[model samples]
Target: MRTRAKLSLSLTVVAMVLGFMVTLQYRQTLLARVSDVTASYTDGRQKELADKVAQLERVNKDALKRLQNLNGEIAAYEKESAGADAQLTSIQQNLSRYRILAGTTPVEGPGISVTLMDGQYNGVGSVSDYTTHDWEVNYVINELFTAGAEAVSINNYRVVANSGIFCIGPVITVNNHRLVAPFQIQAIGDPAVLKGALEMQGGILDLLRNVEDIKVSAVKVEQNIQMPAFTAAVTAPPSEGAAQSTKSSEGKQG
Candidate 1:
């Protein structure tokens, strides 16, 4: 009886071990099948993405080629246009310069140039000239323009553009540059019209001529003066994008 019981227990243990082994092998097969399906799906997606990338690259290449062609066409057009207008522009510019250099242009209209200098002072009751510093010069420039001079310059430097009527010590500043006495002021406008607008008629010019008097000359010169170049002028386009960015380009190109 004892032997039979031991034999039964041994058989039960073997059956249980075999059942667990089969269950583990089935589980492994299921995992392998799932892995194969997942890998196939991933490979399909990767291939699709690669094809899409290839299409986009082709499109970008085509766009760049078109841009280059358009740029070449534009260059040809500008060359032809510049050739057409070159002679006219040059002729006009030469004429303007010739007029200026001839001194036919008037230095002033009807404005006064009051000069102030650092020299011997006239005593009390003695009506003499010569007052120094930046204030006097600035006062005269402003007054001249206010009195109807279209433009004013100290020496050759234009005081109208980014120039200050400031002073350092005895010298006056015109466009940050120092200028000494006997400053030549050039203006272009109606001389007679400006002369009537002066605050102290003969006072400014007369002071330079007589009292504390320095040499200050004001005469109306006919204005054939040429205007200066503007800092921001229209410029040529830089790149394909630049041409495409403008309204004019769109209208013309479209």
Candidate 2:
């Protein structure tokens, strides 16, 4: 009976030891599983953060490219605007010069004036022979131009490229207006040069005094000579289509 009791106690101790070892092993396995899950979650979070940073970098790059394109467009527009302003200024300057040359604008400068009259009634020839003819008036005008006259007028009638000078039944007609002697011929130029040209030996003045037996006063240099714009009609009548268009516009306004 003592031997049997000793065997039973040994069996109990062995069973208890086996139970403690099993419990320890189960706890260790559970701890290992928890560590694996935590590691996986950390790896996923790191990957997500990296992907987000890459996406932001791409967005920033695209935005910078768009900004560069916008800057280039602005520079091009500024250059084009500057070119247009310069072109407009050049066109205005050319138009002003053209208007001056066309004699459509008034002018003022220093010049010379001369008076011409019929020869003194020395009863030697016909009355018409001693009279100042239209040709003689034209001759003086031609001489003034040859002397570098910029503008000229007779009795305040501005002489232009299309001006007409002829005789209308014993009366001299300049631009269709009657002009009698002592014809006042005014020219705009350098005062000294004009005087020199006309008063030169055997010049227009000398020829008129000797050959034509006409009275020509000394050239008078003026400090200021005002010339009016050509008042004669210049523009032609509008075409049929243009006239209709103008009429239509007027009707609309009415």
Candidate 3:
């Protein structure tokens, strides 16, 4: 029973990760297409880009279909195992924990939200200085996680283990999804603790306000905050060395 339960959980996690990775890849492809669509592109180039986008759309659709099938299969297995009350409950509890860790589950609870915006420009030395940087956003996220934030989001984009925050011109991309100021960061955790972490003296708020010159608003504690599951891939791309090692291992097995 233990072995079967572990196997089922492992398979489900693999399926969820693959689905997210496929979605993330599709989003990245779209971002690339957007970047490629410059005024300098010729008619032929535009047509080629359109073709690639269409192909990717089909791929994304197929991946979603597969994920749906996998979910159905898992559901059927759960139904079959429901007869074992004690074992089933234990399995379910473990599954729920893993789902949260994998970020495949949406979470809602009492938490806090912090809003950051660009400071007012007074013919400033550099506009960037008054704006929020990706690192600053990440700093807040890191702080939240350090303070026991179970889940976090920025402008409704779920921040998972593998989520990246980087600047693209005036915008920041999370999970390859672009967002602009003011960025509202919401986290699911203890309201007071999360709020205190951000509002503490010389904390994230102080650094953003005094050093970064960002418009840092008061952290609002809420009784209920909803954060969506990470829809993009949680797995980081394997390094070249790791890929080569896997290939060598496969060769040895063969």
Candidate 4:
């Protein structure tokens, strides 16, 4: 009986130890499973964050491309605007020069003034031979132009491209305005050149003083001479299309 009791006690101790070992192994396995689940959840969260970062990078690249394209368009527009401004400036300059040449605006510069007077001689000669004529005035004007005169005026009346000069009996008519003796012709040009040209051998001055016996005196070189604008109505030459239209209207009226 004693021996059997001893063996039973030993078998009871072994069975308790085996049960404790089994319980410890089961708890360890449960902890390992929980750790695996936690690790899997963290990996999933990291993957989600990485995917969002990749998507943002793609969006940023697309935005950058669009911005670059907008910049290119803006640059091209600026270049075109600059070109248009330059063209407009050039056109304005050309128009200003044309207006100056047209003599529609008043001009002031250095030039010379010529005064022609009828002879005061009381000799036996016709009155017409001693007095100034329209031809003499025209000749002086022509000479001034040939001597590189920029502007010319007779008795303060601006002479233009279409100006007319004729004689009305004892009076000289320039631009339809009557001018009497002691004609003052103001010309804008190099004073020396103008004086030299008029005083040259057998020039207009000589013809008036010697041949016609008219008194041509006093060529004053002035530093500043102001010329008025041509007040006469400027008639523009009709264009071909306008002339044709006018003819057509006349035909219809007829």
User: Which one wins by lDDT: 3 or 4?
Assistant: 3
Instruction: Give a tens-digit lDDT track for model 2, residues 1-254.
Output: 99999999999899899999999999988786768645565787776887898998799658656655764575466555556587765765565456545655556789999988887654345545423456787788888888888877776656654444542211234444455667888889999999999999988889988998888898999999887555454443466798788877896774
lDDT of 1 by residue, 28-54 (tens): 887877686466647877768877989
What RMSD value applies to candidate 3?
24.8
Q: Which candidate model has the greater TM-score, 1 or 2?
A: 2
Question: Taking the tens digit of each residue's C-alpha lDDT, what string does model 3 give over 26-63?
Answer: 99887767766563355787878878989997997687
* Global lDDT of model 1: 0.50
- TM-scores, all candidates, are 0.33, 0.49, 0.59, 0.51
Per-residue alpha-carbon lDDT of model 4 for 39-75, expressed as tens digits? 6657877779878989997996686567557745755
Model 1 poorest ten-residue lDDT run: 227-236
Each model's Cα RMSD: 32.2, 44.5, 24.8, 43.1
Tell me, by lDDT, which candidate is best: 3
- Poorly placed runs, candidate 3 (over 4 Å): 1-84, 120-132, 165-177, 236-242, 245-254
Clashing pairs in 4: none
lDDT of each: 0.50, 0.71, 0.75, 0.73
Top TM-score: which candidate number? 3
Badly placed stretches (over 4 Å) of model 4 are: 1-90, 120-132, 167-177, 236-254
Model 2 has an lDDT value of 0.71
